[model samples]
Target: MERMKEDQDQIYYHSGADLESVKDSPFLEKLIKKGYEVLYLTQAIDENMITQLLDYEGTKFMSISKDNFKFGEKDQKEEKEKNKALKKMYKPLTKFLKKKLGDKVSKVRLSNRLSDTVCVLASDQYGYSARMEIIMRAQAFADPDSFGYMTPKSKIMELNAHHPITKEMLRLVESGEDDERAAELGHLVYDTALVASGYVMRDSDYKSYADRMYKWIGESVGVDPSAPIVEEYPEEEKADSEEEKSDGDANLKEASSSSADPASEDHSEDSSEDHDELLYRSRTRVEDEVFMATVSVF
Candidate 1:
């Protein structure tokens, strides 16, 4: 964070350029001693390591990224409230689209991820985010655009009340009942979201969707999806990283005194997926508890 520290307005001190050069600043030392709050933004910041470094510093280390980027919990509440209204509007249309797509896609459904707009083509758990795809394409590292083009992943059609075009659409649907225009509009909304979510639009020509959106914008103040964000951090996110270091030293002593087993060393190595990640690990910990309990007179 040495170079990045100067760019950050709030950062007080810059540690030297490299990891080996990193040492606690005298200023940070005083702050931690006084029980003050410090937010670490380093990309190299590891929680496990911090848990092991508490001995001399007597400080706590908490991750700010987990607090900031934690979206799963918030999405759950929004999902419940919006999904029903969305399903009512788009469910039939989604089924129709599924038939049109045929063997091209898995299945079609109404999106619970929609807030004020309609549709989003989301990937499953391990799929790449939009920005990540751009990097991969720039480098030509992965099958750059092969899986992107060929994947039969489908878009979920999500209809919303607050949407300007959608408000007009609901009125049209009510008036026409079984109109061809309403179905066309439904297709347009779904296609728009697909493009927005970094997927190729289903329609090569979106002249009608463009005209509809333009007409709506011309009549009103225009659509702005950027909502006012009120930031709140969870208290559960706070943990004492330094406590591990003091515990590590004491545990290491005990482990060394115990009868050495070559098998135990091999087992420890096999358990940890990362060697560098184990650098901050406190000695034996969960294993010690299990060993102590198991070896008791039975």
Candidate 2:
């Protein structure tokens, strides 16, 4: 919370920058640019405590994460107009994302606060911060069903107009509505932004995104995306005949009999065989998990 005079009614806050090494984020950068002195609430308790307190003296505390945060700068009007223009310019792509990513995001709009990043996720005025949701989900007693309702809904995605990635995406959106690649890329962008904002994603959705990423990687590597994987099987070793096995057993018996202290002999080879059995079991288990993941994605 910002230090205030006795008559002051407004307070500004900055959270999640406890460590001195924590550099300026898009949110903090925008605040700094506006010449506001923000009080950083680096500790987890700092935010929850402030939320409980609500106000100090006559001033109401405000969080940077909240959409209602506004710096009363004289040039704010011009900035608002610029942001509105950006939203209008990117309306097609925004609508495309909203439709394609239905329910995953509440809204898509032009970002007014970004400096360097291509896009970022912002919660509504009453919604939970990504950090707060993380804390809630981490609770041991949290019920999946009840927690779903308690969790924040509809994070607003803010896109930067200056970034090359956003620019290219806008171009793709303008190219045509029939562009399947654009739609795929749009989903990728949303997923990336969602994760980057510290929100959890459904396992199935994440797996699908990973599969799409692999396909993209294959294409980049000059491999055909639709091509079937070619597998090379190693040749099977020939099994020993019954007569050879008998001879080998006879030789082993003779050798054991020759040894005065057969029990004292090293059994490392037997132990190695046991280890190999365990290794094979472990490998099979891992392969089974991989298969399950692949199936879930599909």
Candidate 3:
């Protein structure tokens, strides 16, 4: 608090896992760049402590991760006008993002906190910060149902209107030629901001994010992401199939030749003639016996 400038009525701070994490936070980028001194709150209980303390001396304690944070600059009116203009210019893009993101975010708007970052997630003035949410989730035994009941509200997604990605996204949204692609990019950006802001994503959301990433990787490498995976055969397999077919043909030809052989036909004819001769001899014997019997009786 002693480090705060004379004109600054608010003491700014941001909470994170550690000093390194808070030091490189996107929320602190503009504050640090604008020559403001921000306190780093790294402990798990720091935010709770601040909630109780509220202020130091005559200054109020402000969390930079909240949407209500201000820079307390002298030319604030000029900045507000500038942001108002930007919001008007990017109204279509913000609407597109809100529609694409659906209920995941409470609102989409231009960011006054971002300088180097493209986007960030900011909580409501009375809502929980990402750090607080993490601590609560940890204490809630990782139960999502309990967490939902504890905090049912969604955070606001703030985009840097000056960023190149945001500019391109606005162009895509306005042109209407790449709605699908723009929606994909918007969801990706929202997911990134969620993680960057230290919020945990649901399993389904994480799966969708992973799928989009894989699709992007495939496209970047010139592969079709939607194509089906097929099994491929080698030259050896084709050669084996050809060999099997030839073996079958050879076996059929061998059987045909065996059935058409002259030796086999002659053997069959000889067996039939021998059987017919034996039958004729037996009949002649029976007829001679009958003739003898008849002569004796006469």
Candidate 4:
């Protein structure tokens, strides 16, 4: 029964309602970006059948999340030289992150897959994908050393050399006397990469990252880092309460005056009259906005 359950769990698959839904999916994004047609296994039994059959004719099956999956031709000499120079330039930062991240990451390398993204977490060819690892960890029967015989241990962090943030990181390491800030940046980058790769860290680590981010943001915007963490906390709450109380009369006046504005009234009437249409428009607008944001970032 346990073996049957495990096999059933392994026989997983996914299907998109339409091509556009998974058009720029992370699993297929790089391939699509480089112009490749992927055969997506949509049926639940497809993965099981493929595993049993091993291959179709001369073609072998591959996982997109694995490091060995290649899309196009190898990098030429010129491209290789360019990448070598970038690796050389970012060596300091990479070494620093490797030491700081320690056992969390297996290795760090310059990313060839990313075009505009700053960083990505990739598993070694023989290791499980980050998503699969997370699922395993969440299982009731999970063991910390479940795959004890695996040669590869942790995920690899791939940093894009072309991104401005990556360049800034390189600069920070090169600049002397900024070791504190640089270390903080390294932790931030690693945490960001971990989350992006669909893994979660310890709660304490998350809290520490948040505190460091607050300090860095404060320093960036000219806030005094030496200031007390909670200077007059209750007093601050009292002042906020006072302000909220004071706004009540002004809000009432604004509400009274808003009745005289025909445009506001028309808008409110239209919103109330066609609630379903308004909700649909709002949902679509939000979806489009989110898609545009993803495009801009990824």
Candidate 5:
């Protein structure tokens, strides 16, 4: 509060894991670049604590990551007019993103808060902050039933219409020739914004993000994403397999030849008879030993 300018009536704050993280957040790029003072709330309890203290000394506390955040009142009209023009210009792109992102985002719109960043995810005014959601999720892990009622509202994706990637996406969306590519790009941007805004992505969302990333990487390297990966066996491995097969065939032939020989069959029958005779003598000797031992004990 002491750091606020004389005319500043709003105390802007951002919640994050640490000071460096909140300071380097994409959500604060435009605000920071414009010389706006933002309080970096890094403690686990800061978000929850700030909610209770809504206002300090008549200066309202506002999170820059919320959808209802606004800049100074002096240029409010001008900013709205500019945003209106941009919304109209990028209507198709917004529509495409909304359709592609589905329920992940509450809405897709052009952002006035972004300057250097391509996009960012913003929470609802009264909804949970990204940090709060993280805390709630951690709590839910311990007592799932108690926190089952806690469901975070979908985030609002704010895209920088001035960014080159956004412009290219707009073009891809307008052209309709690369609808699939455009959809992939839209999903990629949304997933990136989710992480940038410090929200945990669902399993399916992460899977889609990984698939898109791999596809783009493959495309960049001139590889066909749809092509099947074929594993090639080495010449040495093939030679070894053939040698084993040949050895098995030779062993099988030798066994068959030995089984077919009359002399070998006679020898096998003689060996069986001799084995039975040896077993009979061994049992008789054991019985004799047991009788002698019993007599001595008596």
Candidate 6:
């Protein structure tokens, strides 16, 4: 009741047949500046009145009644008039979300509204309004079970006519959406709406969309999707490998010293030791001579 009042944005100190019976609503003027298709949902916003507003903006009425939407009459008529090749040529993403989120939905269907990217609207405008529940539950004096019985109603997946994702999704789905990308996209749109409407998305366990998104990031960085984790070759093990390598280098040095050839390039194994001894004696003599020369000069 309070929700209906707030939603109506009513004028005070009067009795009227409907909420919009306000002789001159200030809100309506502002809304018109934005050219919003505000359905003048006064007290008379019933089935017949809503039906009359269907072509208000040629469909921006927002008073889509269940009677008008009944049993595929108008939908069938619209579908027949539309290009058979085009709709089939492009995929409707809303259709995917409804199928995935079955029980918590009224129905998921394509929208003709080119305005909003997405909006959470009534499945049956007269049956259960998401806004009504919000308004009723918000009241200081309101019943609990009245709103408790209601859940997030029909999610109206409105695609932005100019959004790249919407365009790509159409091309991709029409081409074939059997791959994970399509699934991820469908999941993203649904999740965006859930978050937008301040509702908790409850399908985390069923689908790891986060994990999939992370893997996509990993792939972008030239990394493998299931790459093995690198274990730090334990600190102790790393020290041992370094020690072994150093010991091997020491051994090679010792071998080279012993295997030197005196008669070959520089020295050979046959007389390398003798050559080293002679070179040592020469160096010693040179050092002694330099020392003596220094002393004489002093």
Worst 10 residues of 1 by lDDT: 62-71
Overall lDDT per candidate, in order of appearance: 0.46, 0.72, 0.87, 0.66, 0.86, 0.49
Best candidate, lDDT-wise?
3
Residues 166-231, model 6: lDDT tens digits: 677666666674645766666666665555433444555336657666676787898887888887
Models, CA RMSD each: 34.9, 22.3, 13.1, 26.0, 7.1, 16.4
lDDT, candidate 3, at 232 = 89
Q: What global local distance difference test value does model 3 have?
A: 0.87
Question: What TM value does model 3 have?
Answer: 0.75
Q: In model 2, what is the error at residue 291, expressed in angstroms?
A: 84
Per-residue lDDT of model 4, residues 23-140, tens digit only: 4334554444554445555433454465467555544665555676544333323446678878888899899878877886888888766775678777676665554555456668
Q: Ranking by TM-score, best first?
A: 5, 3, 2, 4, 6, 1
Q: Report the error of model 3 at residue 134, Å.
A: 0.8
Query: On a 0 to 1 TM-score scale, where does candidate 6 land against the true structure?
Result: 0.41
lDDT of 4: 0.66
Best by TM-score: 5
lDDT of 2 by residue, 196-291 (tens): 656677776878899878877888999887788797554442244556788999999988786866544557567888999999999999999999
Error of 6 at 80 (Å): 13
Global fold similarity of model 5 (TM-score): 0.76
Per-candidate TM equals 0.35, 0.68, 0.75, 0.60, 0.76, 0.41
Task: Flag the better candidate by TM-score, 2 or 5.
Answer: 5
lDDT digits (tens) for residues 65-98 of candidate 1: 1111111234435556666676677555556656
Worst 10-residue lDDT window, candidate 6: 7-16
* lDDT for model 2: 0.72
Summed backbone clashes in each candidate are 3, 0, 0, 0, 0, 7
